[model samples]
Target chain A: MTRITSMKPVGERAIRIGFEERISEETNRYIAALCKAIEEQVHPAVTEWVPAYASLTVYYKPETSGFDEMKSFLESCVKDVHDLEGEGGRVIGIPVLYGGEGGPDLSELASHHGMDEEEVIRLHSEGDYLVYMLGFNPGFPYLGGLSDKLHTPRRDNPRQNVPAGSVGIAGEQTGIYPLASPGGWQLIGRTPARLFDPEQPDAFLLRAGDRLRFRPVDEKEYDDLCSRVENGEQIVEVEEGEHAH
Target chain B: MSFTVEKPGLLTTVQDRGRQGYQQFGLSPAGAMDEYALQMANVLVGNERNEAVLEVTMMGPVLKAEKDMVIAFAGGNLQPAIDDEEVATWKSYHVRGGSKISFGRPVNGARLYLSVRGGIEIPEVMGSRSTYLKAGLGGFEGRELRKGDRIEVGEGAGSSEVHAGRRVASEHIPSYEKEITVRAVPGPQEDYFEKEALEQFFSEVFEVSHQSDRMGYRLQGEEPLKHKNGADILSDATAFGSVQVPGDGQPIILMADRQTTGGYTKIATVIGVDLWKVAQLPPGGKIRFKKTDVHEAQRLWQEQEDILVQVASYGRS
Candidate 1:
């Protein structure tokens, strides 16, 4: 289990819990556990908790508690949950349709890396990416562990509007746009899976620290998957893994 | 009871306090630029603080009331008139159906807030009526109010005793001039800049450039202090009133439309109490920095909150 070395208060009702080591699978597990612990320990006071790539920002109502009191309470809670790390997150598999209109800059990204489209897809699909954080858009996953061969820079001039579910690359990062919005990431593919649905109980399909596996799907499969999603089908499935604590 | 915009001015959007809790997902808190004024206007009309209000920029639109309603206006020094009658702002006024509300040339400030007895009835998106124009997420189909657009007003729950006689104190209204003073504290990333840069920031009066907007106000003056550690930091969470200095050496103060996270280094953050005054400043406005200790900043914040609480209590009476 991971141990928290220090916890610093960022604002009147927020604290930055720092770990001894850089963010890893274990650190991520501890973060989730810490969030759960904080939520349980400090009930109504904890208004919001945002998990970042390496840190968790806990926002609370200042009216309920002051900075010093909250910091001390968090310190005590951290000590209690010192060894309370949870099992690793479930690994999710997402099927993506690559190339053509589905991915306008696939060829450019492939050629930029001195690799063909097939090689790019193979390298990208082979890696088990880690969901570092969810940001840039609602339910948009910032996945790490991109293959070196597939690493590419963001477009010089991003499209004014990138459609929802569009998969794109920015430097070593890969993500799916959960909603249609202006983006600058280099588009390489798109997922028929609904990354976010406000109507659902859990709007976000994925959370930070979850393991992801991308499977290449053909154009026909892409259309079929989209239709399935429109019909209220949850395409992505998670498989339970052994506890890694 | 509502109104139709006969001629939309510079920019008009339905805005309330803002969408909170969604910032982690890259959603901006696209609320009223001058939250103080917005809240004041709402209070004058007996509406909740978060009720959707109209954020009119610079010159306001010519609006035709479709139904009889009580409306209140605040923020800046725009001359708002109803049917050629000069009406005092920051107070509730009764408008007959078909009455025309026109905004004359701007006398001072950049933005204005208009609140009705019952707030505008727009579909709440992600728990907010504030318009995020870039993402097209909330308020009037996620866009600015255009000419010929009809806005619906919810029924007022407060008394209809016609409190049109009441008006907000003029002393509370912020004055927008060529130069403005903003109080700020060193940011989390303030160490990134050189000590000399920090001194330069306080010594110089930065002019608000023309390239400023709701997202960020770009300043034109002395180049911001540069960082020797030039590696682009991973995008991290940002907040309203955060003063980020990009590579260009100019400071950009993030506002309502700022992204949840950004890569630029923030040297300082405008204290919450002064943010409303900052919002009222138009482009080309000169700004002088006043560094305050965190304790003083917090004290001022508490004082402002106390004032707001007092004002809010008055609405209940």
Candidate 2:
């Protein structure tokens, strides 16, 4: 049985439901199942639900439901969430142009790992990464699968401006910069995929429970895909994957 | 039904209640920092609570009304005036076409709201008029109001009644102060910190850092709260009022424009009712925290909402 350690109030209108201290697939699936049940049951006052590595934070409208009422409602809802089998997140492929302008730190990262840049790209592209959460910045995915050999510390002095679509690695995790902003990640490559677009029916390219893989592309191919994405073309491919838990 | 910006203020932007149902997509609910003030200003001028209004920060914009409009100012006092004639805040005013409205330096608080009846007629993006400055997504052209910008007002936004002389009851208004006691509910991660750090957090008086903005209020105070397992936590979903303490140990109260999730441990979350109070606090203002449970926090919020409802009812009368 998946254990839910506690359900505490984040404030007046938001509730944080905790599972355990560490990040694991079981916790992620439990959160997903819980989120599924809540959405199915539909708490009228709940305005938003955020699923993360270990917990799900629910934001609600105070005027519609007070803390006591909501606490009980969530307690009841959790009791009915019996199925531990979490839904399989869709697998999406992100095409990247590795090395050179798009990947300024690729050589540095490869040298640090005592491997060639091509080998580094091969390791990164072959792994199946899980989308633990979307955070830090809009549409930024916190992915969970990184080859230990390619582990690199973040830049001591963060970049004033990291270009949008740049793929970077920090510690054991890898992610893509959804927007051009200040960051400390070690840039390895760039993805032409539009991670965030308000105009799309689905504003964000990725969600909390999704599987992603990187496919290496040449600079010419990157330019072609970039134009296609900019022109509102869905160039990336998404397919079904195995259930999380 | 329209106005022209003669002089754009430091950070004037259109805001409303906020954009809902989008936080899951890594979008923050960017809206009026001081919802209480925005709501009151909207109600006084016969506009809906969600109607878009101008949020003025520190300095205020110089606007020239192109048509007769019923408007109200709320929140921090920027010493608003029409053609050099002072106009009292918290009350609706009937201004004639060609009236020039300007504001002096802030007399109190950090943010002020200017609402015209019928609301700012800006197209909604993701179901909100509030500006998400980081994404450049919504509000007046996805950014702050600039000089020479023309803002259109919604037709029939104003009620026939002038609403002049109408003011929120004195007790209903929140007086901006340099020192404030903000109530908070202990954390989603309160246990992550050491017992000594928790004591230090509750006992210390922290001053808002100079870098504090709509995104979050960074605090500068005593030794940063030390976590038993270091400050690093699995990046988790953060609420609007989340008081995230980073590696530096400074506390940052995530606000309307905060990120959807954070990696730091949140020691506490300011109650929703008190968020507006924190919003009004200027950078360098002092804040002390008092622990309260969720039940008490909700009761206080409901009480405040009831008062606002009673005040809004006065507009109808």
Candidate 3:
């Protein structure tokens, strides 16, 4: 995606800057790059900076600085960051136990797509999904790059409560529930990894721009992983790439 | 120092200034509905500004003092009585151990704030004591005060000499009535509506519909002007007092328990200075809107802040 060419006033105190490209894969890359660049430069007066799937919201203290100054400052920083290509994204592998009690809706979901449960699982795990954004709930990743064959509409009526760590698909996107919440996604499997825990220093386990690969595991393995997690074993492997600028 | 809940009233929850800096995470700043009153109550008893206070809605509970404590109460027109005689509110008072404090029906306003010296002691969740009822997180066990709940009251190192008969000026006291006037600023999504709808919004008198709570207040008024793109918009961040008109045309004022984001278009936002007035309005209160610019709104907010600072300083003295 090209650099942000212009910044427009959103309100009395904030401005919205858009890149040349509409929200796309390249736009997501720009979002991550701009967030890191702005954090390194012009840190003060900024109360909060929230980066969404396609946009970044920068909230500043209006009393301290005017809108014009913040706009110019952000514009300069984005121009500089555009010259440097952003760090390559990290890939995370998540193990899941599909079908049976672990995934009650697997049979039903397969039938809805006119395929067997094994083919559904095979298609789902074969492709790598990109983390578009973290939203809806804490640590819940909105994943993109789903295979067209496994694409399915959400349940007509959402379940009152979907257990945490349940992997599901909705329309063109797929995600894992970080916590028990009402959801309309079609569940295909359950993961043993914990996506969110308030007690941990870094409560959120996933972030935007991270890639994920789902590896299938058995019921015995799921039970064993849970036990290991309870015993303070780290189930998910996270790698910090050298390219992060 | 502590207090025991003898009869937990209609709805009682511990609240502070609010949970700020987390709206991006889909969390509302679930603070006291009447923040001005909460602050005044805390300042009256020498507690910090964000100290936890009991936000009692409509009627209040009967609280029995477990120990001798100094306390202050503000907001609403509830008759707080010790045994039989009525006691004045908005001033600090000393209560002996085992004294019983109960409340009568609210004569005016909808919420009352009770703050004790040093503030109520509770575990902070997500850096706040305010209760977000829908999420079932923060505040006393992530729920409202129930019978048999014992709440601890903070005790500062220094104790001051007792004084009596201090009260807020009669003119300054908020008058809760059947109608309230709200100052507002056009929102980012205001242009989505027709020009005539904007005109009707300011000129018309809207009644507070029955479906109202901490989450939102649905209004009964003239239908909102439709847009060319219809009511479908991407879900985005929303704040308190956001006047959002859904497909039905009725405007819903997003409140403390409102979701972090919404897809409906917002017509306007109630100015910060007038939010307290909106909070005090009863379910059936009539409301009229007056449009103002963001500059004027900011100026009014500064004026309110100045007044609050003066009041807080006077209490300290």
Q: By lDDT, who's the top model here? A: 2
lDDT of 1 by residue, A85-171 (tens): 345677999999988897899989889888899988888888888886676666777677887767787888979989988888888
Q: What is candidate 1's lDDT per residue for B1-317, written digit by digit as tens? A: 67898999989999998887766555677898888889888888877877899998888899999887888888876889989888877788888889999898788888889888889998887788999887777888789888899999988623374556567766666666768888877765666787888888777899988888888898987665666565245555566687888887788888888876666777777877788777988888899888875556656767766776777678768
Q: After superposition, how far is residue A245 of candidate 3 from its true place, in Å?
A: 8.4
After superposition, which runs of candidate 3 have C-alpha atoms over 4 Å from their true positions? A1-22, A41-45, A60-84, A229-234, B161-166, B170-172
Query: What are the per-model numbers of colliding residue pairs?
Result: 1, 1, 0
Query: Higher DockQ: candidate 2 or 3?
Result: 2
Candidate 3 fraction of reference contacts recovered: 0.09
Model 2 residue B231 lDDT score: 82
Over B1-317, each residue of candidate 3 has an lDDT whose tens digit, in order, gives 67899999988999997776665555566889888788878777767777899999888899988777777778886878765567877776777788898999988888888888777788787789999786577888778998889998776512553433345556556767779888887765676788888888888999898789888888898655566467755444566677888887788887777765566877888877777787878888899999887667666766666777777777677
Best by DockQ: 2
Report how far off residue B119 is in candidate 3 (Å): 1.5
- Native-vs-model 1 lDDT? 0.77
> Model 3, residue A17: displacement in angstroms?
5.8
lDDT of 2 by residue, B33-125 (tens): 999999999988877777899999999999999988888999999999988898878888888889999999889988889999888998999
- What level of docking quality does candidate 1 show? acceptable
- Candidate 2 residues lying further than 4 Å off, grouped into runs, are A84-86, A241-245, B158-161
Which candidate do you rate higher for DockQ, 1 or 2? 2
- Clashing residue pairs in candidate 3, if any? none
